[model samples]
Target: MDASELDIVDRPAASARGWRVPLLAFARNPAGSIYGTVVADSVLAVESERQTKLSDLIYAELITVIVYWFAHVYADFLGSPPSGSRRASLHRLAVTLGHEWSLVTASFFPLAAVLLAAAAGASIQTAALAGMWTGVAALVLWGQLAGRRAGRGAVVSFAYGMTAGLFGLALILLRVLLH
Candidate 1:
């Protein structure tokens, strides 16, 4: 079957009875639950290393942003615990990790593209073009995913910008403090 014609069904749906659907849904949607786990890991990595590069820092921030959007999307689509409830707090924390992961994933594409272009001795214009296209494409993909799952593309865009800003700030602070 042609790739476009192949109806990709999640196999886990078969066994997803009762609470399994919610759990598996969260698991499968990287933006949903998986994002939280990824952020926690990145944070821990930074904490353990005691230092990080600008690129790495931006990457972490971006991931956190995506993760936040994911959590927002999930909570919005599938009712969440009442705001400020213990359960809600816990869920938010987990979702935070997932956002971090998504942001990091998003950042990696652009960074890698730019670096590869530079290494190849491409012109400055070519490097910038590669980075810009890669970054935009990644964000668009994420936004489309967000739209499908949450009915909001703005959330994805917001997260992208917010993550970059926050992470960039943190990195600057860290550099100043450590330097």
Candidate 2:
């Protein structure tokens, strides 16, 4: 099972471990659970409200995954092959997939979490700011990975920017329409 699935199954166990230990553990490994918590919460909220069919919810999550994949590719491997490199092409493919995986891990999870938090009555300021920061961090990583390729970096950055913007827009629309 995926990390999110694991979290759902273990949340009771974690709670049984006691709130204090879990809180400390959460504080210690903030990044790891933060995203999973968000996605799980969002999934639960949607499932609870019956606003979306299960198939559609899964599809939406898949789109979020795709966005991350593009963002990663735009960030990491957009330039010419490295110098004196016999494995340049292979490295390119590998980085491309790595970026895709990063999207699954980094970007979408956080976005989903923010959305879930908002649904759970988190303060608007908290959800919006957290989401923005998380999305920006992902974009920054993408740009940094893009390195010296001016055009490539710009493209990748733009894609991620758009991804983040869409995330915000979707959340807002969902909030208004769902309630």
Top candidate, metric TM-score: 1
Error of 1 at 10 (Å): 3.3
Candidate 1 lDDT by residue in tens digits, 48-163: 24423434534554566566666666655356546667787677767655544443354555556656876898654455345545544444444444444564566675565445
| Clash count, one per candidate | 13, 1
Number of clashes in model 1?
A: 13
- Cα distance off (Å), candidate 2, residue 77: 2.0
In model 2, how large is the Cα lDDT of residue 63?
66
Deviation in Å, model 1, residue 113 alpha carbon: 0.8
